[model samples]
Target chain A: MIEFHLNSRSGLSPYQQLVQQVRHALRLGLLREGDRLPTVKDVARQMAVNPNTVLKAYRELEHDGLVAARPGVGTFVTRTLADDTLAAQGPLRKDLRRWLAKARLAGLDDESIEALFVSTFRSTAGEDVA
Target chain B: MSAVLRARGLGKRYKKRWALQNCDLEVPAGRVVGLVGPNGAGKSTLLKLACGMLTPTAGTIEVCGGRPAAGVEQLAKVGFVAQDTPVYAALSVADHLDFGKRLSPGWDDAEARDRIRRLGLDPKQRAGKLSGGQRAQLALTLGIAKRPELLILDEPVAALDPLARREFMQDLMEAVAEHELSIVLSSHLVSDVERTCDYVIVVVDSQVQVAGDIDDLVAGHYRLTGPRRDMDALPAGQHVITASHTDRQTTLVVRTDTAVHDPSWTVDPLGLEDIVLAYMARPADAVRDTRPALEVVR
Candidate 1:
């Protein structure tokens, strides 16, 4: 079972956070197809969040075709996101590590490195959309 | 959708002073609703009115599809845990459970005993000796085991420490999930409300300022910062809730159902706390012309 935790400082709503965490886990291969999610009551009791928030998150995931709920049973993952990108992660991690080392050598601090990476990623992604 | 609580021009007066006035609200069933405002902002008055503990001087209120506390049946449909989580000081935990079983026709004896055990509360310990958190839990147990359709709590965790507070909220949420219970809890702590409630009611200066689903409220409200300009020149759809201006910039929190397309202004989405605070910060006597028609209908 995948345990859900909320980051209050993240600015995302609780439901959004839950949806994102499930996607992140799916992409990371930590959660595979057929894995049952923790019950709404379990999540609400453990996380101290409104059960409605958990229900909304699960519904959104089901709407997105990532999970499905069986009446009287529990919600289960129906899709795995790790197929396409997981294979490329190793090379991407190596490249990112190299880039980080080079940036440090050039005297860029962590914050500057993050800002540069984010700006470059955004502009490139925007161009691809256009 | 049926409303668990409805009020129309509801007002309460204490002889010479009006504690709450011109309040109108409709809270839908099966949702966790939070009532929030500053101290003495009539949050308690509104909750009390819904439970029929206080008679309205001006208008009517309906709870659980009937006048609150109208009869034994109506009373059975509503459970109230007042401020500071009042419990009978002279009664033991076991005594309280027995009292609940004897008094409430729908009392869930197994559930009551299970909760007391899970809370690690000694059945024989007198409520007068329980810690604040424990007392709150015991009171909540009674409230929940009574099997009311709606549970109304007034600042239930105001006296709890941070850890105890978290525990109490967890239990409450669990109860909601298991029993399909509707809850109306009041708290001045916006963060608690943000995490624990799907619907929110903001009371300020003895009036109902705004009420809506939390998501809609957050989505409809925006913070815009731009060059100083006349507030009256804004688009008709944008209703200013609060505004501040410096020599060069005007910052405003506004409510609008449409997108803010003004290229010159930077629009930022607000968190639940920020939205509530913006409403609370609004001047009590601010021009009603700028205020959006109260959207409590939903």
Candidate 2:
């Protein structure tokens, strides 16, 4: 079972945070196909959050085809997101480490490096979509 | 969606003072609604009016499709936990349970006992000996075991420490999940409301400043900063809630239904706390001319 924790400082809505955490776990291979997600009541009780928030997050996941809720049973993961991208992570990690070292050696601070990476990442992704 | 609590021009008076006045509210069923405001904002008076502890002096108020406390059946439809989570100091925990069982027609003894067991409270202990958190939980148990369709709580956790408050909220949410109960809880803690409530009602200076779904309220409000300009020069769709200006720059919090397409101003979304604070900071009589009275938009 995957236990969820909330970061109040994250500035994301509770339901959005739940959705993101599930996606993060799926991509990290911590959750795989057929895994049962915690029931809405359990999550609400454990996290001290409204059950409707949990229900909304589950509905969004179901819409994305990542999970399915079976009547009178718990929700189950229907897809694994760790297939294609998992294979390329090693090379990507090496490249990212090398670039980070180069940036630090060039006198960029941690915040500057993060800002640079995030802006470049967003613009590149936006261009691809456009 | 049927309204669990509906009020139109509801007002209450005490001697020469109006505790709450000109209030209009329509709360939909199955929502955990947060009623937040400063002290003396009349949150308690409004809650008392809803549960029929106090009668309206001006207009009508309906709860669960009937007048509040109109009859035994009407009283059975709504449960209330008054301020400070009041419990009988002399009674034992079990005695309190018995009292609840004898009074409420829809009492659920098994559920109440199971909850008490999970909470680890001994039934033999007197209520006065319990900690503040424990006492609050005991009161909440009474409210829930009655199986009311709508539960109204007035500052239920204000006296407890943070940890106790968290556990109390956890139990409350679990009960809502199990019973599909609607809630209207008043509090001064915005962060708690943001975390546990789907709907929000901001009562400031004895009036409802704003009420809506939390997500909708957050999405529809924004903070804009740009060159100094007159408030009247703003676009028609952007209704300013609060504005502050320096000689060179103007900052405003606005509620707009449409997107802010103006390139000159830097617009950023606001968190629920910021939005509520902005409304609270506004002068009671200010901004009435700029926008119509804010209402719950379905």
- What is candidate 2's CA lDDT for residue B72? 92
Q: Candidate 2: misplaced stretches above 4 Å?
A: A84-130, B290-296
> What is candidate 2's lDDT per residue for B74-179, written digit by digit as tens?
9889999999998999999999999999999999999999989999999999999999999999999999999999999999999999999999999999999999
Tens digits of per-residue lDDT, candidate 1, B1-298, equal 9999889989999888888988778889999999999999999999998898999999889998999889999988999999999988999999999999988989999999999999999999999999999999999999999999999999999999999999999999999999979999999998899899999999988888889899888878899999999899899888899999999999999988877777688777899999999989998876356434565237
What would the per-residue lDDT of candidate 2 be over residues A105-127, giving only the tens digit for each residue? 99999999998987577456545
In model 1, the clashing pairs are: none
True contacts kept of 2: 0.76
- TM-scores for all candidates? 0.92, 0.92
Provide the overall lDDT of each model, using Cα atoms, as 2-decimal numbers. 0.91, 0.91
lDDT of 2: 0.91
